[model samples]
Target: MDLIIIAQAVGLFTVTNIDDIVVLALFFAQGAGERGTTAKIVAGQYLGFTAILAATLAATFGAGFLPEAVRAYFGLLPLLLGLRAAWKMWRGDDDDDAPGSNNGPALLTVATVTFANGGDNIGIYVPVFITVDHTGLAVYTAVFLLLVGVLCAVGRFLATRAPIARALSRWGHVLLPAVLIVLGIVILIEGGAFAL
Candidate 1:
């Protein structure tokens, strides 16, 4: 049981590396001018991620089931989502015109961006839950949740700092698309599709 939990946690951690990069980019892009805003964005991201993890785990433990074929199909989801993020990054529309204009939109925008950016993680989680041992699923879920929360918090903290924030924000646009493209290629390879 412990081993299973550890394996699932490791898998979740592996899958989340790409997600962390994307979420960090999104927050950095949105909160370019105001470092304080990064906190809210990070909070919303973790909230959305928690919600998705709960839902996916529920489905996996409940009557829901995921076959190997479905898992393979889901493996492609990340690649597609990565492509979408790459496109969004290339378009340079990460800025929210109404971020500080109102609290509601600000929170919602953060949640929406986090959720949208997290699509790939959400997709892969279902399979991860299904394949792992039942007893370990809860622990795995908790570990993933905590990992994401910590990563987002650290990213927000780093982005809020003056020098780092400015430097990261300056190159965020270029970095975002490049990261997404590389993630997409890696996911494709993992999904048994050659990017070449």
Candidate 2:
């Protein structure tokens, strides 16, 4: 593996996954006290990212698996999640005390959200994948997976900070919904799902 290729892989992964830091941080805050939460999150992150890589790699191989238009629909996942959160707020259904109640299976929920949020990642990754040879592809995947672990660690560190965790706990319910809604809109627009 050339150093340039390694650098490119690192850069690409970092750029694509920058937003995931905050998402992971929020999850850490939410799962603060629960046993095995960190393990679940790390596993879910890997699961989700691996799926994204697989989809992108498959596309490179002429799998025709997920056209951009079809992938755009994945944005609906976060959009609906935001709407659901807003609905809960409207109905005065508090999730503060019951973190797990509305989230469904935590691991799957994280994985689903991660995958759904990866539409842009797929768009970026496929072009890069197309340019890379088999060895280069392996290098990229390794770098990406390594970065995922780093991201999880950083997210946990940030969430464990007193000020950061306190603020997130205080405002995350409102913030997460808005962020997800906006992210969904961005993904849809980027994918050309609809015009403004």
Candidate 3:
């Protein structure tokens, strides 16, 4: 059980969420310079993550169960999402922050972006969630909920760090997309979604 808890935590919180640090940091940095914006970003993070989890659970265990054959292909979601991010970066569309500049997008807007960016998360979460027993599932859910706050706080702190934040906002476009594409490949292989 302990090992399962750790594995589940790593898989759900860290391994599958590398891209999130970038996105979350971006969200925080987007509002870090503005007063009261950090709270909004944190709230949006929780709200968006909850929605993603709810939807994944429903698809994994709902009336119409998710299929593994299809699950393997879920990897494509992240792989392509990464490519898209990279493309946007190449196109100079990435909203890079200069140390502490942020428009502080609306809380709702932040949530929407979070949800939208979670396409990869949903793809990986479904199979992982379904494989666990109820107890394990509960553990994963609880840990995820708790870690989310920590993740947000870390992101906010990083945003306040000018040098690091600038680098992340600048090079994140390269590193994050590469990581996501690799993650997608891993999920595809590990989930046996491409066994065919």
Each model's lDDT comes to 0.56, 0.80, 0.66
Best by TM-score: 2
Q: What is the lDDT of candidate 1?
A: 0.56
Sort the candidates on lDDT, descending order.
Answer: 2, 3, 1
TM-score of each: 0.56, 0.89, 0.63
Query: lDDT of candidate 3?
Result: 0.66
Which candidate leads the pack in lDDT? 2
Residue-wise C-alpha lDDT for candidate 2, range 16-36, written one tens digit per residue: 898989888887886787777
Candidate rank order under TM-score:
2, 3, 1
Candidate 1 has a TM-score of 0.56
Model 3 pairs in collision: 72-193
Q: What is the lDDT of residue 121 in candidate 1?
A: 62
By summed lDDT, which 10 consecutive residues of candidate 2 come out lowest?
A: 96-105
RMSD of every candidate to native, in Å, equals 6.0, 2.7, 5.9
